[model samples]
Target: MTFFTFVTRGLTRRPVRTGLTIVGIAIGIAAVVGLVGISRGFETSWQTGMKSRGTDIVVSNMGRGLTPKPFSATVVERITPLPHVAETCALLVDLISVEKADMMIVSARQWGGFSWKNLKIVSGRLPNDAAERAVVLGKTAAEVLGKKVGDTLQLETEELAVVGIVDGGAVVEDGSVILSLPLLQEITGNQGKINIVDLRVTPRTTKEELTRLCAQITGLVPEARAVIAGDHIRDSQAYRMISAMSWGTSLLAVLVGVLGVMNTMLMTVFERTQEICVLLAIGWKRSRIVRMVLWESALLGFLGGVGGVLIGVVGVQLLVTTPAIRGLLEPELNPQFLVMAVAIAVVVGVVSGVYPAWRSSRLTPSHALHG
Candidate 1:
C-alpha cells in the first residue's frame, strides 16, 4: 500500500477515538472563527456606515467606555466654519430600552445635516423639522418594534409619532432608532448635549492637509479629539475591548484543542507500538515510521479544520440572525481567515505528534516486538 493510504488507514482503524479528537479540535476552531468574525464585523459595519454617509472625520470624546461621552452640541458650529470643513453634524448616541428591544442604539442627528441623508425613506416621510415632536424608524427597527408610519412610540417619558420607516443601507444604521437631535435631547433630559460629530472635508484635500486639520480641530476643542474615519475603530477604546475579549476567549478554546490533540496522539502511539515494530522489522526505516505517525496526526488536524470552518461560518450566520444581535453588524467573513484556520490546524497536528513520533522512532524493533 502507498504511504499516504497507509497513514489514512491507521487513522481509520480506531474511528471513534479519531472522530472525537477531530471534533474537539473543530469546536475550538469554530469558537475562534465565530468570535473573531463578529468582532471584526462590528468594527467594519460602523466604519462603513460612517463612510456611506460621507463622513471624513469623527470628532468625539472617546474614553474608556464603548460609547463616547456626551458633549455640547455647539461643537459642530465651531467645527463647521473651520478651513477644509465643508459640512458638519453632531449626534447624540445612547443605548436604552425601547419598546420590545431591551437595549437599542438611538441616533439623534442635527436637523438638516448631511448625516440625515443616509436614510432613504421606503415609506412615509421624515419629521417636518428639528422640533416636530416626530421620529423616523429604520426599516429593521420597525420590524423589531412592530411599528409603522403614523404609530406613536414612547421615548423615555415622552410619546412621539413615527412618521417614516427608512432603509439605512448599513446594518448598524438600519437597526438603530433615529430621530431629530432636539426631540431626543428633550426626552432623554440631555438638552443641548451630543456625543459625536461627523465632518466632511472640502474636495481635493491632501492626506497631510487632513492630518493638520485634525490637529487643528483638537486644538480648537481641547476636550474632543478628531480622528480620520478610516482609523476610527482602530483607535476606539470599545473596539479594542471587543477585540481583546474575542481573542482572549479564542485562546482558551485553542488551548483546549491542543491538549486534546496531544492526548489522542499519545494514545495512538501507545496502541500502535507492535504494528510500528513490525514495519521497522520489514525494513521500514526509523525515519519512515516517525513520518507515518506525524502524517496520521496531521491528517486528523486537516479534517478537523475543514469541519471547523463550516461550523464556524454556520454558527456566526445563525447567531447574527438572532434578535439580540440582529441588524447590529454584518458578520465579516474573509477568505484569508479560512486559509489561516486550516494552516493553523495542520501546524497543530504536526506539533502535537512530535513527542509521539519521537517515542516511536526510539523504539528498537526487538524491544517493541517483545514488549
Candidate 2:
C-alpha cells in the first residue's frame, strides 16, 4: 500500500476522535481568519476613502501622538491664503458611547463646502439649518443606531433630528454620524474649536509644492501639523492598536490549536504502541515510523484548515449582513491571509507530532509488544 493510504488507514481507525481533533484545529484557524480579515478590511477601506476624496492635505493639531489637540476654527483663515490651497474646511470629531451599545465616533463637518461634496446622500437631504440640532447618518451608523430620517436621537443633553443618510463608502464615515460644524461645536462645548482642517489644493500642484505648503501651514500655526491625507492613518495610534490586537488575538487561537493537535497525536501514539512495535520488528526504520506519524498529523491539519476557511467565510458573511455590524464592518477575505491560516495549521501539526513520533520510534519491540 502507498504511504498516504497507510496514513489514511491509521486515521480512520478512530474516525470520531480524528474528526473532533480536526474540528478543534479548525476553530482556531477560523478565529484568526475572521479577526485579522476584518481588521485588514477596516484599514483598506479607511485608506481608500482617504485617497479617493479630492482633498489633498490634512491639517490637525500635533499634540500627543494619539490625542490631537483642538485648534481654533479661525485657523482656516490663515490656511486659506496659503499658495496652492484651493479650499479649506474645519472638522470636529468625538466618540459618543451609546448606553448598552457600541461607541460611535461622530464627525461634525462643515456643510456647503468642497469637502462636503464627496458625501452622497442616499435618503433624505443635508441639514438645512446649521443652528438647529440636526444630524446625518452614514449607512452603517443608521443601522447600528436603528434611526431613520426624521427620528430623534438624544445625543448628550440635546435631542438631534436625523436629517439624512449618506453612503460615503469610507468605514470611518460609514459607521459615524455627521452634523453641522456649528452644532457639534455647541454640543461639545468647544465652540469655534476644531479637531481637523482638511485642505484641497489647486490642480497641477507638484509634490514639491505640496511639501513646501505643508511646512508653511505648520509654521502658520505652531500647534498644527499638515500632512498628506493618506499619511494621516499612519499617524493614528488607534489604528495601529487595532492592527496589533487583531494579530495578537489570532496568535492565541493558533496556540490553542497547537495544544489540541499535540494532545490528540500523543493519544494516538499511545494507542498504536503495539502496531508501531510490529512495524519496527518487521524492519521498518525508526525514521520511517516518525514520517508516518507526522504524515497522519499533517493530513488532519490540512482537513482542519479547509473546514476552518469555510467556517470563517460563513461567519464573516453572517456578521456583515446583520444589521448591528453590517455597515460598521466589511470583512476582507485576503488570499494571502487565508493561505497563511492553512500554513499555520500545517506547521502546528508537524510541530505537535515531533515528540510523540520520537517517543513511539524509541519504544523497543520487546517492551512495546509485551506491554
The stretch of ten residues in a row with the least summed lDDT in candidate 1 is 362-371
lDDT, candidates in the order shown: 0.86, 0.80
Question: Model 1: per-residue lDDT, tens digit, 1-371?
Answer: 78999889988988999999999889888888899889999888888878877899999987876678888888887888889998998998886788777767789999999999988998999999998988888888888788999999888888889999998888878888899998888888899899889999999999999999999999998778998987776777878998999989987887787788889888888888888888888889999988998998898888888888899999999998777777678888899987787777778888888889999898778855585
| Predicted structure with the largest lDDT when compared to the true one | 1
lDDT tens digits, residue span 256-301, model 2? 8878888888898899889898888888888899999999888888
Worst 10 residues of 2 by lDDT: 60-69
Instruction: Tell me which residue pairs clash in candidate 1.
Output: none
Task: Identify the leading candidate in terms of TM-score.
Answer: 1
Off by over 4 Å in 2: 61-69, 74-85, 98-101, 202-227, 321-324, 365-371
